[model samples]
Target: MSLAEKLCLTAAFVFFMTGLLTGIWKYRCMARSENAVAPRYVDIAHRSSLMYSFAALLLGWFAGYSAYPDWLNSVAAASALGFFALAIGTYIVHGVLRDTGNQFRKPHRLGRSTLPAWVIHAFMIVLIVAEVGGSLVLGSGALIAIW
Candidate 1:
């Protein structure tokens, strides 16, 4: 791959590693709690999010780096952010929604998770915007300056 491609790949790989770390921390938090999330369920979410994130990463890299066009970079960067933020965050939100959905079951205090669902949604939105904007600026500039 070209230098630009390599740079994008490095960025994505770094992001993925961060995601992995976040996943591990979240699982650890769950495990310590009385109402711990199951490993199997966590695994499923992890795998799903990882796959989608990887897809976004690769696609964005190729489009931004290989093609090196403004529009292409914009598209790929936005896509990278969207898929990574939404798809991964969705799994987490859905899990909480599912757990809380059961009216009959009154669960324990889930630390800061006691916050309303809207908060999580809003956080995800902010993260997405930041990622997309950041990626576009960084990737686009890199393509221009380096490639």
Candidate 2:
């Protein structure tokens, strides 16, 4: 198979994985009411998992778009690097302040990145947000917006 095909498959896999993990994590979070082991942290980790899945989707898009630059995965390595940096920064800010970021001005509540797990979860939420947001913003939008 060509590099594009391989990347496409990889991207598809990532998308599927993201959806799958999100569903499972959602289940676990809900199940916590029934089971003691099911803590909110599972959801936190799943949030990041969802982000990975999104990043994969974007990379796949980039790959399927064209087979140029073997390293140019769908989101671009540079973009991924930036995403990670954002995740880390958000995690740190939330952890230190125990509150939502002032810049983004999100409400400061339970998911304020107080614990390590919360930071990771925030990272995932932020990551996927960036992924989907990037796709919408940077993408040509032909495939996404048929309207």
Candidate 3:
């Protein structure tokens, strides 16, 4: 596998580990009190981490098998890794803070923290564009190779 593929796989492993750690935290919290509802973000983090890990693995495999150039694969892998890391990190922060309910269901008012919010949105947009664009390039390359 190329270095990019390897790095993607490594990110997958890190995500899996993050999931396991979150799971442990959830279990401990539940064990401590019957009425304790595991933090919404904790559950989200655990589940999403596992899902993202699988996604990274699949993306890596696709990149490896496809006829795309190494640079394309590198971009895809890097984008996926960045998104996964930031997403999980956000979840972890929310979980740690035990913030007000689900941030998704009701948007939290970020009165003074516009910069962080803007940065996150920008990063997410760029990463998603890179990932999707890379995937398209790789898919086209594969199709061209087959014909």
**Candidate No. with top lDDT:** 3
Model 3 clashing residue pairs (backbone): none
**Candidate 2 — which residues are off by over 4 angstroms?**
1-5, 11-15, 18-22, 34-38, 66-68, 71-147
When sorted by lDDT, best at the front, the candidate numbers are: 3, 1, 2
C-alpha lDDT values of all predictions: 0.55, 0.49, 0.74
lDDT of 3 by residue, 8-41 (tens): 7898899999999999988777777678768777
Q: What TM-score do all the candidates reach, one by one?
A: 0.42, 0.37, 0.79
Residue 32 deviation, candidate 3, in Å? 2.7
Per-residue CA lDDT of model 1 for 1-147, tens digit only, reads: 443344456656755765686588568867887878644334445666566557556555545444355554555555455556565655565454444432223332233355556665676687677656556655556566665
Judging by lDDT, tell me the better candidate of 1 and 2.
Answer: 1
Give the Å error, residue 141, model 1.
Answer: 18
Candidate 2 or 3, higher lDDT?
Answer: 3
Worst 10 residues of 1 by lDDT: 102-111
lDDT: worst 10-residue window of model 2: 101-110
Q: Residue 44 of candidate 1: its Cα lDDT?
A: 48
Badly placed stretches (over 4 Å) of model 1 are 1-15, 22-41, 97-147
